[model samples]
Target: MTAAPVEGELAMVGEVAEQLRDVRRHVDFFDNDVHQARDLAREADSRSLATETTVAGFARWLERLEQSNEALRRETATLRGHHPPDPQRPPRHRCSRYAPPIHLSALGEEAGDTA
Candidate 1:
């Protein structure tokens, strides 16, 4: 006979699904806003005036969205403890090639050493 799901387990699953849905909705909203901001920034760029304010506003919006996304991810991880791909650890593979340039002078090291 198949075992039935416990009340707490079912409740947790429902909560997780709801949270996942919320995360998706927020992501969609954030994406739409970002697209709109990009369009506005492009328009401002075409004009004589600087688009700094518009771009800054878009950056702020993106920051908030990123924060919310991170929080939701943490919450989901907590709900599903001991799952694969532990959030605390970094991935093994080198995902990207965009490393920030190191300033040797700032670090009190010779620039030649960095080569």
Candidate 2:
């Protein structure tokens, strides 16, 4: 009876040791996971900061462009006020440079009449 109890106690001790080793392995795996998560979070933070800075730079550039556009508009209005266009003359077309001036005799030929 005494020998049987001692054998059972030794078997329980071996099982407990195995379980403790498994627990240690799980703890190590969990620690590695935490470290990787922290690294990922840090990388995300850096990328977000870079994006924000780039957006801010673009915003400033856009503001400057708007101001320049407004100034050019004001200048154009001032110039137009100084030298108003001749209302009696038609606005010139870009295609006018590519073709000869149309005459009244050409219109008559297209209509089958010499007017």
Candidate 3:
């Protein structure tokens, strides 16, 4: 039978995922600004009747921010799919203090990068 990923390996993947997710999250960290930009664009339509350049510029920026956020979400989902968490395992998430078990046998080799 194949061996499962060791707890430490899973923890490392989890840590990496968390860090990467955090970085991706920062791509659109200004959520408030996105919403405000959208609101301003809508209001500008009423105030300027689609004549103001600033409104269109803000609209484009907001759209790009939204797209980036969607892409990041997709990436996070893909990452989770590859490294699902096992709550039963220790070294939960970023808690990497738990030492990795010794795995020198064939099964350990079979575990691949997962440990």
Better of 1 and 3 by TM-score: 1
Clashing pairs in 3: none
For each candidate, give its TM-score against the true structure: 0.36, 0.63, 0.28
For model 3, residues 1-115, the per-residue Cα lDDT tens digits are 1335577788899999999999878866778678889999999777786566678889999999999997887788688774434458764455463567765675766677765
Top TM-score hit: 2
Worst 10 residues of 2 by lDDT: 106-115
Instruction: Please estimate how well model 3 matches the true structure, expressed as its whole-model Cα lDDT.
Output: 0.76
Question: Where does candidate 1 stray beyond 4 Å?
Answer: 1-5, 49-115
Model 2 CA lDDT for position 57: 100
What is candidate 3's CA lDDT for residue 83? 47
lDDT of 2 at 3: 100
As a whole number from 0 to 100, the lDDT of residue 46 in candidate 2 is: 100
Give the higher-lDDT candidate: 1 or 3.
1
Shift of residue 54 alpha carbon in model 1, Å: 22
- Could you tell me the lDDT of residue 114 within candidate 1? 62
Q: Write the per-residue lDDT of candidate 2 for residues 1-115, one digit (tens) a residue.
A: 9999999999999999999999999999999999999999999999999999999999999999999997887789688674434679886686864767777766766665533
